[model samples]
Target: MCTYLKNMEGYKLKDLKLKEFDSIQEMFDRAFKRQKVKDDKETTELKQLMKIILDEEEVEIDVIPLAVKSPSIIGWKIRKEGRKSYYQIIRADGKSQTYMIFSHMLKSFDREDLENLYELVKAKYESTRPVEDLDLILWGDLKTMFEPHIEDKVWKNQQDYKVLNWKLYDSCGVHSLRMQHVQIYMLVEKKYPLTPSTLTMMLEKKLMIDYESEMAYQLLKFIMK
Candidate 1:
């Protein structure tokens, strides 16, 4: 090698064929710029998702989601020792609300496709999410029970309606109302340690019944006050 070639230096040109060193620098600059653009896009999309999931009003005795930003979570669940576990839950009140999510009701994302992505940033707690998202559907799954209650006499009326087979299965804002052939309590009872979607499938398979006052009243009367 010539003495001039050995001594000439700025950035290393060994990777480039010496003549293409300038081209290599330009390529590096463009690649870094593209990466920045992708990051900005992800941040914006993620923020929009949070707005829908994190901002929701809690329904009475319902496991509804609270407000949360990305890298935040406030799901409802029960603990093994029959106690509530407290966490910094983002609420619709535009402030941080603390809720003791029952550990029993916490659902882990089990999809193999998303499992690898989740493993990227696993937390000590199973129910915790890395960020908060928005919930566009305000009513969510509990919408069916919010309907009017009807019966032979005045089941629709709150005064005449009796708490028959009702039972508080899990402490994650879930309850079961019993009536006639349909029983909705089991639906909530089995949701512990699983996602709501999982329990929904159990109902679809005819393993669960709809909201029925008969069983709810009977169960509540026998088991709880």
Candidate 2:
């Protein structure tokens, strides 16, 4: 039993006697049944949606270039917390926008697969030769979210990357009604340790700094009311 427990990654079976094994087995059996039912339901729903889309009279299928049709994995960042590891892959839409996919508890990656992905991004970057002509935008990291601001202000002011745009996303400007407000609320909720009221105050100040005082006040009054 000691050897068996030691073989486990971080779990201990010493406290779990043979009597508890039956209960654990039963619980896993029930969970498996529940998952199968849920998967079947989702499969049926997807089939129905696919049928409807295929049978629609006015539905159109416009062919796009192969390059534009596929999502490109440009870069990645790896993070480790204790024994768990996470992989955040940066994906570009072959257009101007980029987003991140945060993977949970990734077990491992094939060396050849990673090499291929790196080469793909490198090729894309090289295609736009004469480096000075290439333009790119990288989003801020959630970990060191604001340290760049202090560094930029103190020493790199002249070379600082200007706030080309803000409010959730640069491309999502103006077209998304009330989305910027929702984004601010979500950002505060996810990234900051603040209550709703405090977040509102912080957002108001941030907007004011961006010369959006009127919008800031309106948001505060509306949300607080």
Write one digit per residue (lDDT tens) for candidate 1, span 49-142. 2211221324223334443322323232222224433433332344343333322122221122122222322332234532322111111112
State model 2's lDDT: 0.32
Q: Please report the candidate that would top TM-score against the real structure.
A: 1
lDDT of 1 at 210: 29
Please give the RMSD of candidate 1 to the true structure.
21.6
List lDDT for all candidates, in order.
0.33, 0.32
Q: Which candidate tops lDDT?
A: 1
How well does candidate 1 score on lDDT at residue 13? 54
At residue 67, candidate 1 shows an lDDT of 30
- Each model's total of backbone clashes: 44, 0
